[model samples]
Target: MRDVAREAGVALRTVSRVVNGESNVNAEMAGRVHSTIARLGYRPDERARQLRRGSSQTIGAALRGTGGMWEHTAEHTARAAGFMTLAASTEDDPALYAQVIESLCQRRVDGLMVEPIGAATPYLVAEVEAGLPVVAVDRPLEDVPADSVVSDNAGGIRAAVEHLLARGHREIAYIGDSERIYTGRLRAEAFRSCLQEAGLAVEDASVTTGEAGPEMVADALDRMRRCSAPPTALVTGNNVISWQVLRQLGPAIGELAVFCFDSLENAELLAHPVSTVNQDLEGLGRTAVDLLLARLAEPERERQHIILPVSLSIRASSEVPPPPRARRRRAHKAQAPSS
Candidate 1:
């Protein structure tokens, strides 16, 4: 700080204010300090300063995939509050997740917003204990007592199921991502609950959950088709599953009732537009940033777990009613004879 101030011909306090992201420094002096900083290859001691003061004016984001709208919204919100966002994708790997978080901590980012995957992160809990402000987004960190913002997975599944049931579909099948994922597990459980509440037996074949792959989906569909009473409706666990199922079904998309758990853009352009339960991505992102900021402001506040509400977007696909019972039976019988 002293060296930069001397080079820029400014007071040490002015250099401190500029380096710490404090407001009210003169624009010209601040500019000169920044120019000196650039010329001298000077970098502030962020970790030491963060220990005395409370911030690095930067946030580290550990996201599940490539930073999308969720990351963009979070970045924008944080920037508005004078924080820069640094992000890295976990790619759904535990080793990668751990490495990313550790690397961010080393950079002394003021806080973290993570889209958790894989398993419980006790490593993250240690950071929180040491005064790192952390917020979970999309999914909560298992066993970590951090504020989280996520969608109502159960509610979304309920909406889809009720819509199909109202459309006269008794048998519904589901294809989901791996049960290891938080969203996939919650959604699968929700689907079973919906069926049981409606007085329907839970058929193991009616739901297939594992890591999503075309082979797994095709086999699940084949098994459902072979049921004594085949499903007339399908509720996919997420947008990826919905599209995978659609790709396999091809021309059959319009014939079967389908409800996807996530929103699809330009869905109306399809032969049969998919109905969806929309998760507010922007809201989730912004809320996560706000929560992290609040945490930074008052580190002693009680932790909050927020579940944002979801809305249904009905389209052509889910409105398709169940095939008539006679036709269903005949189709089964005809296939049986050939087999």
Candidate 2:
């Protein structure tokens, strides 16, 4: 900054104003200061600027779990964007979520990005109503008015179902999350609609919804197999459930086609690579930042819900053939000819 001031022929205060984006300097002086700073490769101290401007230079993110793959990726993305992330998980509990939100608000974070635990918490609704800049990531708050960035769950699930149908799979099963989250509900609805459109009925016994633990997924798979007519293809709601199902199915994965909402990190290593509806994690993180920044810039703008498109990754897991039918018996006319 001193070098920039000297090069621009301006006082230290004038250079500071230009760098902080404060008004008062003439256009020509501002341009000179910017040019000098660029040429000298001088970068402002963001921490100092935050302290001087009363900004935190920090953002709070509420994740589902610390060990989860998605949360780790989100944290890396946030750090790469030059923002400090204060992360907390609610374990899908509303009370825990409320407590976390209160703590983040008391700390006065510049903004917040959250994957809401349930439908819509009263605390979250109040926060948005109070003009806080909040961005919903992955799972949206249904009743709360806030900027949201989420993958196209419905479209992605529909594509998966269609792919299975194209492979001659008439009996398809679905395993999803607890319908408490918006993404789960959307994907489940899409699965049903796609099956109906294809003139196939979604049997109640074939659909399973619950926690995504390994034991739970194993039980669900067992139930599906016990059905009078088992499904030849299955669509999992998200990554966790997909892994659980895969572990239980093991080598027999080829017998039942599979599709999932989100892709795993080492998806290629599977015996039969599982197909997935891939979400751009980096893009989603950047988009959440963009929304929060926009809200910070203009608070009175209308709330926006930005839906990012999900791409279908076709793989061997979704390539199973339909079940074979019983062959008809040959006529017994040979006995008469012999007589």
Q: Best candidate per TM-score, number?
A: 1
Which pairs clash (backbone N, Cα, C closer than 3 Å) in model 1?
none
Give candidate 1 regions above 4 Å deviation: 1-54
lDDT of each: 0.90, 0.81
| TM-score versus the correct structure, for each prediction | 0.89, 0.79
lDDT of 2 by residue, 1-339 (tens): 888889899999999999887899999999999989889999999778878987786788877666554556556665776568888887778788888888898777888988887745777767777778999888677777888888888989988998888888888999998776677788888888998998988788667887678877887887776666677789999888998888888898988889888987778777799899998776687788878878988999988888888898888888878666321012222222453
Enumerate residue pairs that collide in model 2.
Answer: none
Tens digits of lDDT, candidate 1, 58-126 = 999998887578889999999999899999998888899999999999888889999998567878888
State model 2's lDDT.
0.81
For model 2, what is the error of residue 124's alpha carbon versus the real structure, in angstroms, after optimal superposition? 3.2
TM-score of 2: 0.79
